[model samples]
Target: MTDFPEIAAANPAFFVERVLSVHHWTDRLFSFTMTRPASFRFRSGEFVMIGLPSEPGGPRPVMRAYSIASPHFAEELEFFSIKVPDGPLTSRLQRIQPGDPILMGRKPTGTLVLDALTPGKRLFLFSTGTGLAPFLSVARDPDAYERYEKVVVVHGVRQVSELAYRDLWTREIFEDELVGEQARRQLVYYPTVTREPFERQGRIPDLMASGKMFADLGLPATGFDPAVDRAMMCGSMAMIKDVAKALEGYGLTEGSNADPGDYVLERAFVG
Candidate 1:
């Protein structure tokens, strides 16, 4: 995607960032980090448009909304993406290497941020596949740890290899100088691979319904207590809807940036 000479040469409305590194997690999933603009400011769990020039000497560009996987406080911006075989962007995007260019949108926005929900004792971040990207950002943000007593992150994937950023959550974050110890103590990661053999192997919705996820975590016997738990969900619209309906059943209400409440969600993809 960055091979285009014209795209790399221009930087008017958008920012062209240099790719720092790229790691292929699986044939279908990968993650990349790029230099961040000093002037760019965004909340931890927000997303921005990113893509390549449309074509040779074309005026328009190929773009898609991508969640910023790195925490806002970090110097670099990271993104987790799926390599759809026929996706207009990912088809070519999957070939990107370090030192290439990436076009980033000017404005970053989303409803999955911590600000969209009210204060609470526990924070639950539920996601699936690449949907886990935003929660990765939220997990690294020092504010998330400071705001809530416990931060529970659940990531569901088809295979164990798809559980991205495993080391960051298990090792690096805790060893970090700024929020390491606090993050280690406050963050609880529960990763599930639905199609693979693992200690935990069920979709989050099923885990919630069966009270098995809560039991594993030693949560209250009745499950969610909206009075103390606030949550954020990201994934396919179907997954989000199912999780949203479940949260509502637990006495939680949907919230937004304008009106903070018990829970909030964002569509992983449009219908």
Candidate 2:
């Protein structure tokens, strides 16, 4: 496996930079925006390694790969994170405030971008938890609407409270009079809570299995040809596996940076 040079060096001082802003969504979730170095550039759906300075003068740093939540045009970088009580990165990261230093990497790379898929009539973005980050980037880009006649973003969370930014953005973008007309006609936001009662309640796999998702959207459950539909998935390992299997039955093939196809899959976190 290839090891990241800075992380492999285990040097905190060289990588640390000050934080810019922080917004807490729930007890377990928050989003922060940080200054992007002048030289930093990334595609819409890529991720970068981030870390927090360990000690005042210590060398050890806590680092992990985080998907870029802000669009490419944004001046600052943004990340949506979950607070794991004892997670090496989030344990200290969750306590950060503006002016504090957070280490960041130079390059950003991933396989979740819209360019990785062929043009289709409809685009489906399926996510859970922080997995919704990349889709947030894609939905904000006008090119996505131009390429796909219809866009459906389905987010499955453990609770309604966990559906923070996704719900906020969907409402904002689809309601703005300037963008609302196009977004309203082309975009569909489907939110499902696995642990809470809401308009929709169930895992994404279950929704697909029972045809409720398609029926609600007035779409056909089967016969998903690559020419008309494309999909992107990001979530836990189990969710990815289950959703991929379900898509396969409908004739979707997984795509990647090297080979563009009908669908793409990415994990929200290593764990």
- Runs of candidate 1 with Cα error greater than 4 angstroms are 1-11
Task: List residue ranges in candidate 2 displaced over 4 A.
Answer: 1-16, 175-181
What lDDT score is found at residue 179 in candidate 2? 49
Error of 1 at 237 (Å): 2.1
Best by TM-score: 1
Put down candidate 1 lDDT per residue, 213-240, tens digits, no spaces: 8899999779899999999999877778
For each predicted model, how many residue pairs clash, with residues at least 3 apart or on different chains? Answer: 0, 0
Q: What is the C-alpha RMSD of each candidate to the true structure, in Å?
A: 2.0, 4.7
lDDT of 1 at 49: 95
228 Cα displacement, candidate 1 (Å): 0.2
Local accuracy by lDDT, each model? 0.88, 0.82
Provide the lowest-lDDT 10-residue window in model 1.
Answer: 1-10
lDDT of 2 by residue, 180-267 (tens): 6778789989999999789899999889889898898898766456668899988787788888998788888888888888999898
Tell me how candidate 1 scores on lDDT. Answer: 0.88
